[model samples]
Target: MNWDRLQEKLSILSDAAKYDVSCSSSGSKRTNKGGLGNASFSGICHTYTPDGRCVSLLKILLTNHCIYDCLYCVSRKSNAEVKRTAFSVGEVVSLTMNFYRRNYIEGLFLSSGVMKSPDYTMERLTKIAKKLREEERFHGYIHLKTIPGASPELIHEAGLYADRLSVNIELPTQKGLELLAPDKNHKEMVKPMDEIKQGIVQYKDDKKNKLVKSMKFAPAGQSSQMIIGATQESDLDIVKTATALYKKFDLKRVYYSGYVPVLSDEKLPALNTSVPLVRENRLYQTDWLMRFYEFEPYEIVNADFPNLDLEIDPKLAWALRNREHFPVDVNTADYHMILRIPGIGVRGAKKIIVARRYGRLTYEKLRKLGIAMNRAKYFIHCGKYYVSNDYDSLQLRNLILHSGKSKYTKQFDGQLSLF
Candidate 1:
């Protein structure tokens, strides 16, 4: 193995892997028992160095060589401009071990473009993961990106070694998949996710029944990703699909990657098209409201309003649209009602519930409990502070939007806060 050629391959493959957004290492409880490393439940690759260098996961692809040509993808097999390379299983193992030892990365986030057959590529990926676990005794988090049409047997074997697994849904709708990625099938993608979910369930049942000493099958659970803004699919379409995936497959996370125009195909957006980062951010906020805040997909977006308001977060947008639910009495409101308030988070809502038991909360006291008073003040009434002016919905929305703008201005001006 030539070290120089390996480094060249690493640079190309790592850059190619950045398009994948489903690599978060959260909810994995793989502990190091006389092993090289441990998988923390909190997450990995989320830390910053003293010089502000991010020492996160070593995210890379096993190969950039592909047989199928997806129009939206930069590493599509037909793209002659892209530098192609593939990493042997041994090279990946050596790199992962070395990176862990040097403390450059806390874990591995491995993906690949299709090389030869799906099963052929998957078998190699599984071997790298197996070597990391059994041969190397490396306990650091391993997140493998499973191929869509890979056999169920290889997927099950992958779960035995990987802490987490992901299968990229690629696009929001089946129509989008058919248009952009003719080589991919929506049903094929969901098949692996379903198998992985069942494997996780089976492992738990085995452990409970004492059928196995330690039933390990992706303890962290599975996740998937969707490329946003590629097709004309609405935010409603995206979130609705995500909601179904969570309900049907019991997925941990649904990552949304803003479509960055890389390949200039007539079927795709122009190469100069700006990345819709803010739209992606709004989708994530909408996702959080659904997962943590108990928000339905329809509540965030509907047939009339199929997209989220780009100006504000989804929680605030929902509150604005449904003003009749507003002005909730913070002191007397239930936990769910308090959570529905614009500025109050899960932690803040719990705090309000506990604090109200002792005494009624004022705006000042609410601020101390981590509420974003600027936004919440419009929707919540507590203590002696009653909203004097009954502003219309448009007026109230402008007030909140301006408040957000001002807060960001102050932050840029170096107005720092302790909490």
Candidate 2:
């Protein structure tokens, strides 16, 4: 391949892969040792040092030539306006190796548009990872997109090499997928995911057997991406689907990419439609609450509240909705109940639990634990410093909203004030 031509393909394919938000490099401790690169378990993206040099993951598509014309996608088969290109398995392996050698990127995130078929596309993707490990001895993070409808054998092979694997859920609802992405099926897409899940399980159980203990398979596990705001599905619907994916597949992450209108089509949102980034952030917060904070999906949003309150985060909103659960005794409340307080987090709650064992907690101790006392004060009583008993739910909500325009609320206001 010509050097200039390769760079051109790199530009196009890398730009094309931006829509995927599941490119975060974490959960895999792929050490370099004598190899060319290292993948830190703690993820980092296009981050910069004080000197302003770039440290980014080389996120790119193996090809942008698609067979299906999904209306929301920029590189759909019917869309001729966008440039199309495909990198050979050797080219991608070479590119990733060269890039890693130069310290340009920490890892490679490889996805592609279905080339000839699911199996054909998946073969090339798996080939790159396999060659990188066997030929180049590359130990850097490799995240390979498991093409939907690919065979189980191919997916299993992919798991053997890639650090993490992802199968995009695309749209939130089946109806939306049917209307826009007619070529795809939800069940067919999930088949590969199920296979990957089983592979991960089998690999773990196999590890117990000394013969296969040295082998690793998709060590970072699997994740999926869902496009938000393109279809009419509410936040509640999105979280529900994510909860199902998490429970069924044992996924590591469910990434939400706010839809960006790339082309004008009768079946798609208008080009001028604003991307719902705030809504995307809120959905991620709700996901965190479910995965880490012990909040159920329904607790975040349900039939009565289909959409998250754009003005407040899901945690604060939940506290506002269930005011009766408030006025908790900070000194006596269990760790779980402490987590329910508006301003307390898992770490803060744990700290409170440990600190209270030594002595009764006062406002000073709570602050020392990094609890947001401004918000917690309204719902917590500690050392005779209880909030006034007069405020109703409505009043308390307002008080929480306007009482302190701290950096957090100011940033929140900046994000949502446009509405």
Question: Using TM-score as the measure, which candidate wins?
Answer: 1
- The per-residue C-alpha lDDT of model 2 at residue 156 equals 91
lDDT of each: 0.85, 0.83
Q: Which stretches of candidate 1 lie over 4 Å from their true place?
A: 46-55, 267-272, 404-419
Pairs clashing within candidate 2: none
RMSD in angstroms, all models? 5.3, 5.9
lDDT of 2 by residue, 368-395 (tens): 7888887777778787556545556676
Q: Score candidate 2 by lDDT.
A: 0.83
Weakest 10 consecutive residues of candidate 2 by summed lDDT: 410-419
Per residue, candidate 1 scores C-alpha lDDT tens digits across 1-419 of 79999899988988887777777788888868898999988767943422233437888989999989888888898999998889999999999999999998888999998899999999999999999999999999999999988999999999999999999999999998898889898899999999999999999888898656754999899999998887888898998899999999999999888887886676554434755688988998998998888787888899989998888888988887888886788988899888899888998888999999998897789888888887777777676554423557777788667664322111223543212
If scored against the real structure, what TM-score would every candidate get?
Answer: 0.93, 0.92
Candidate 2: count the clashes: 0
